[model samples]
Target: MIPTRIAVIQGDPRARVDLAVGALAPRLISRDAARAHIALAAAGMILLGGDDVHVDVSVGAGCLLEIEDVGGTIAYRADGRRSSWTMEVHVAEGATLLWRGLPFVATDGADVERRTTLHLATGATAVIRETLVLGRHGESGGRLASSFVAGDADGPLLVEQLDLDGLAPEPGVLGAHRVLDSVIALGFEPETTRGDLVLEHSGAIARHLGAETHTSRLDRVWDEWVKRARQRTASHVDKPANEAAVGGN
Candidate 1:
């Protein structure tokens, strides 16, 4: 059989809500799901038997938007064969975008590569969080390679690169840990208040993660926060590479 590829693109209208996709279709969250202008679009994207998946997004001027996933995204590890996923985002001035990506979990022994790039214009605000998990609890077979780059109109701002050879452990990377996640949020500069909101609201995020893991409870909620920071190799306040930083993590 063959795999299906999806593309999506979004643009901002007069008041906001301008989002689109290239090939992938999105499931919008119920208006009752959240507050004004905020929308959650997620889909269970499958990597077909013989194809890859790609997603693209754009935000127009004077718009405020938020994108999130319904749940963790599972990736099937291909043996020596390769599979990939890519996301490209563009943000215009006076516009705001919050992209909360779900976790990516690789199957054992599967070979996979994924990349995400974001471009932002001056006065354009955005926050993005990406999480990747090496392997599931007990399953293991293939390899996972991933990279991310974010920049604005001026130059580069943030970059993350990772490579794992096999199901086997990487000394400093994953070590023996099978599951890992990363969250990166940008913007919150002039406002400054948003960063604090994230910290206070992070309790829900921590509790949610605790619920997800279930069995082994973390001694301190703040511990998970630190782990996520290490995985992405970005400070709490740093959004992609294009914008100037404002606060501390």
Candidate 2:
């Protein structure tokens, strides 16, 4: 059996020490470097032709980490085997991470499964976004199974799952076209005025890309709907104990 792999390349600190604070602390990171890191990591994984892929990322406190892929990840048609990608991120307190992975293009007959789990400690902030493009231009194949989970110490903060099978592009699913994207922002609440600004920015992007827009307060979405949903019912109530038994706690 061939082994799966994950590559990580973090940036160096580039902050000056405050005379009062004593030691220098990393404040911000370069987005260019971040994109390059993911690009190289994914490129290496693609070359390996493995049966599975897993990536885990951790950012220490007071460090700013930004990650982006060079371009879309294309998963070719798989044989009988399945390909999987997993990302686990831990953003410590007083840190920021702008982690966004580009659109993943799955060609015909491809069975790719992807999951992302983010753990945000108090005072940490992160903005994460992912886009998926179903089936390439031609030579149609298989569906993409994706799951996203973001949470803190208490429980899940957000969860988005996708099981797009046997479904082509339509008005509701992936819009009139065949591309869909979602974003999540966690940690400190944005001010009312700033909240409006964020919405405006998202609207501009939606208009530019010709994609449908959906935005909600993460808290309200989780409390009113997510917490009461079908999968969520089992997730928050029953899974933690099971996870603890498995040493996942």
Candidate 3:
């Protein structure tokens, strides 16, 4: 079966939703205060062989958009075919986008490919989170190829690719880890702690690799980055009001 496809666009200074479209079980769940939440409603046993899902999102100048998943997505074992999921995002100047992705589990014999591409204009910001788990307890996982590319009008901000197999330990890739959690923040420079991968560009990536119990390694970094991003956005939003107040006085 073909995977789900979803697209959303937010425009105007008020951050109103200008367009929204979805197919194959992914739909907009709610909207409030310039924020929209999308949910994946795929029924039991998702992302089987030959499934292909695509999501496209666009945020207009000065708009804000948030996306989330209702629950974890499980990729069942494949029968010699590959399943894939891809997301493409575009953020206009001064726009902000936050994607809270839930866990993706790959069971034994599963084959999956996941990819994301982000394009940002000057002053645009984006925050994205991902968690990949290899198999459930007591079972070795399958094969996965995960890749991400992000850039702005100026230049490329990040490009990364990982090919992993749960049963084998690569020399330099994931080593012996079974879980990988990551958070990517772009368009702003925030203070980071040790272990945070600070990029040359105005962004940082924090990742955790280990058993599921080690997932907390990314919690502190993710929380701090999210807080900083929200604060920055709030300041930008309040700047005009403050300037107007001063002018009136």
Q: Look at candidate 3 and give me any clashing residue pairs.
A: none
lDDT values, one for every candidate: 0.49, 0.47, 0.73
Q: 113, model 2: CA deviation in Å?
A: 0.7
For residues 1-249, could you state the per-residue lDDT of candidate 3 as single tens digits?
343444434423322443333333555544434444455555445678877767677776665666667677778888999999888889888878878887888889999998999999999888888998888877789998999999998889999998888888578877777888998999998677788889998999888888883555766776787777767567433433211111011
Error of 3 at 117 (Å): 0.5
Which regions of candidate 3 deviate over 4 angstroms?
1-15, 18-34, 40-44, 235-249
Q: What is the TM-score of each candidate against the true structure?
A: 0.63, 0.60, 0.84
Model 2, which residues run further than 4 Å from truth?
Answer: 1-41, 45-50, 139-141, 166-172, 190-249
Write one digit per residue (lDDT tens) for candidate 2, span 162-249. 7764355434554544455544556643333223323322111111122221322232322232222212123212321111111010
Indicate whether candidate 2 or candidate 3 has the larger lDDT.
3
Poorest lDDT segment (10 consecutive residues) of candidate 3: 240-249
Pick by lDDT: which candidate is best?
A: 3
Candidate 2 at 157: error in angstroms? Answer: 0.6
- Candidate 2 colliding pairs: 108-140, 108-141, 109-141, 109-142
Error of 1 at 122 (Å): 0.4
Q: Which candidate is the best by TM-score?
A: 3
Q: Least lDDT summed over 10 consecutive residues: which range in candidate 1?
A: 240-249
Order of candidate numbers by lDDT, starting with the best: 3, 1, 2
